[model samples]
Target: MDKFLLQQQVLDRLAEDLLQVEQALREAHETATHEENIAENKYDTLGLEAAYLATGQARRAEAIRQAMAHWRQFRPRPYDASQGIQLGALVCLVDAGGQQQHLFLGPDGGSMRLLSGTQLVQVISSEAPLGRAMLGKYEGDGVLIGVGSIRQQFEVLQVD
Candidate 1:
């Protein structure tokens, strides 16, 4: 894989997302304070619900904005093949059925499915269970992850 190409792709996607989120938040903030949104009766929850929804969206957008900033400022350094997985690492995991999945560890982009060419790249965080397990593990290493009642196994096939 071309690291430079992938980095640019991910960065572009995140930047676009940031713009859309900001615009939506701005529009919502404007409509949230219109006179029509004011409640006529104390028992009526329409205004309250509308206000809550706007506030919630604002908070969510704020979090994404902060994370997008981190992504923009992050400088991805080249890692040796032997090095453990960290930010900017593209990892390939193999399941029992020999199915392979590609995941890109990033500073911040949220959970997103991004397509570059014909491949789908999934953004993952170090806080995630599988992401945590991938740290410091070399090729041929196996890990078992359990979420709720399901247990899954994965083998580290490659890291680039």
Candidate 2:
């Protein structure tokens, strides 16, 4: 799969998420300011609750905006053997049971799955645990990742 195309797809998905978040933020803000929601007594906290929800929605919208900015500035380059696996590398790893998993290493705030043709590829940040373990690893290299108390092992099958 073309890395540039995949990057574009990620950006498109993030854009959609941003739109949704903004809509929710707008609704929450309106609800918070609505006259009907104003509290008449101390126990009546509808307006206060709505204000808190609006604040949370605003924060979520800002986060999505930042993620979109990061994705826009990101550039995916061709993989080099000397560099091993890094951001922009499409890596395939195989477990002991011969199960193959595909991952696209990318920038922050892109931990989501995408469909490339019939295969589903997981997009992750290099700072993530699995991504960190795969970094600087070449084909045929062994990768080990520990999550909580569980350990998972996989061999690098391909890097492109």
lDDT values of the candidates?
A: 0.75, 0.91
* Candidate 1 local lDDT, 1-160, one digit each (tens): 6655766676677677767766776766666677786778887666567667778777877777787777777676676666776777888899999999998877655567677678887878777888888877777889778999998999988888
Candidate 2: 10-residue stretch with minimal lDDT: 59-68
lDDT of 1: 0.75
User: What is the C-alpha lDDT profile of model 2 across 1-160, one tens digit per residue?
Assistant: 8888788888899889888888888888888899998899999888898889889988987887888898889988899999999899999999989999999999988889999999899999999999999999999999999999999999999999
Backbone N/Cα/C clashes per model: 0, 0
Off by over 4 Å in 1: none
How big is the positional error of residue 55 in model 1, measured in Å on the Cα after superposition? Answer: 1.1
lDDT of 1 at 17: 74
